[model samples]
Target: MRWARAIHHLEALAQECAVMATRPASIFPVRVVELWAVGDVLGPLRDIDAVTVALAVDLPVEEVPWLGQPRGAQQWANATRLDRNPIVGLWRSVHAPVWNHRVERPALVWDAENGVAEKTLAALHDGAGERVRLPAPGAEEWRARLTEELAVSVRALRDCTAAYEQRRWSPGKLEPVADALWRASEGYLDVLDALHGPPEPT
Candidate 1:
């Protein structure tokens, strides 16, 4: 496949660079990272087309079933660190492409056969949201995983690029969403640099 070939070529290039390097080798990051974007609580997502837009923008997104009968929702987010610069993640969502487009919308979020449903999402609620089943592993764990408010803002910006892809944006209209995401990546990358520990003393 094309992707496989691309990876192979990249790996070859890295190997050669490592072999013939005069300068010391720092971390070589080629990992693919996807973004997370959620539109609203208005309705659940039934279409991957929206997600497709996210992917086309060089980031993969997941659909979580939240509103409108659990068709589309915002679910857990997990990004694994790959050698300090690259991270890879898998998104769990409320929709699947296993069936036709029609069936795709309003995707199922549960195993009907066993009558098991997700409790973190769409469950009995208590005032103040103090108690609820959030798909995130656990409350403490989720909090530990979250970077900051700015990171969330940036994630939303990554989701908003769909308008440009759909031929819907006009000069008359503002593009704050797109603008914000660009800025967010800049800040997030900074954090990456700090934690990565200063370019191997060179």
Candidate 2:
């Protein structure tokens, strides 16, 4: 009931209102759609990716990041463990090249004119909660589209939830509907999958 209620709540907010968002010169360069495909939220106050932190926040990868303590500083610290020591000079090589926990290269993906930066992530919203479960039109329609996609997805997942959780259906029993839901959410999930890279061998 809770999950169904949650889905219903999100579905209701599928229509969003727009607000002004300026394209700055070089921070938060990545758009919401890409971030969502990889599973992250949008907006200025939200945290960007770990790689974004290293570059935008100007934290050296070698430093003992604050570690995912609770706040941004702590999450930054968690990027480096016993592994990386990025080379400061060209022809780059680290004291321990493997120490790098950073994935994005700001130098490459940044659109300085627009203030967008590079990042790696999953397709989710940072502000995601019962209230934000519904999607709305944000800076780009992608968020709106994702909201719709999520709405449809939640409904689909609900079916499986019913059969698996409530109906107590077996594999074959839920196969048809499960396959349909998977097909529906596949496009959106692909976006998240891209940020993560290829799926592991099954």
Candidate 3:
């Protein structure tokens, strides 16, 4: 399944990040690498959820399953015109969050990331100092545990995909597998959160 493949890619990225973190290097560089690694995995993680949702909804396999439709020229022009309007622009700038809330946002893989890359970056920075102070497990052990958990999550996703393909009309058929996948993914994210503390206040 595409979702399973994405998770596998995430596992690989996590392993790479863990190894880099363990290397004898300055803390700043190590943290930088970790932030970059998080950025790298974000794509695959998004893909995993996107594909899973597409499959769950029985979207045609031949069709590209985008979570949100691309804006057309007219839509872009309207947005540009609105931004050019000084009065509207001023109001939007003052109430950016409220204005943004009205926009359609994709259902991102990690809701904690808030579909904002800056939040993820802030998360890394917020945790970097504390992570250095925390006593972490051995690098090899950490990698092994994450790899194992990811493997199980991948397998669950694969099984769910197969079940969907075979008997899609069967109600609740994919629930167990989907639940397992969700739990496993959450566990993986929890491990990372532990390693790097929570995101800083906006």
Whose TM-score is greatest here? 3
lDDT of 2 by residue, 75-193 (tens): 22232220132111111111212112122111211222332222211112223232322233244454443343344344545544564554345544765445444543553354334
Compared with the true structure, what per-residue lDDT tens digits does model 1 show for residues 1-202? 2322322322332333233222222322212122221121113322212211011111222221111111111111111111222212122221322111111112122231322223312321111111331232354433333333224334544554454445445655555444434544554454344333336665
- Candidate 3 structure quality by residue, lDDT tens digits, 148-176: 43443355445545755665566666764
For model 3, the local distance difference test gives 0.30
RMSD of each: 20.4, 20.7, 21.2
Write the candidate numbers in order of decreasing lDDT.
3, 2, 1
The residue ranges of model 2 lying beyond 4 angstroms of the native Cα positions read 1-139, 167-173, 184-188, 191-202
Candidate 2 minimal-lDDT segment of 10 residues: 12-21
Q: Candidate order by TM-score, highest to lowest?
A: 3, 2, 1
Task: Pick the winner on lDDT between candidates 1 and 3.
Answer: 3
Candidate 3, residue 171: the lDDT equals 65
Model 2 lDDT vs. the true structure? 0.27
Task: Report the C-alpha displacement of residue 71, candidate 1, in angstroms.
Answer: 9.2
**lDDT on C-alpha atoms for all candidate structures:** 0.26, 0.27, 0.30
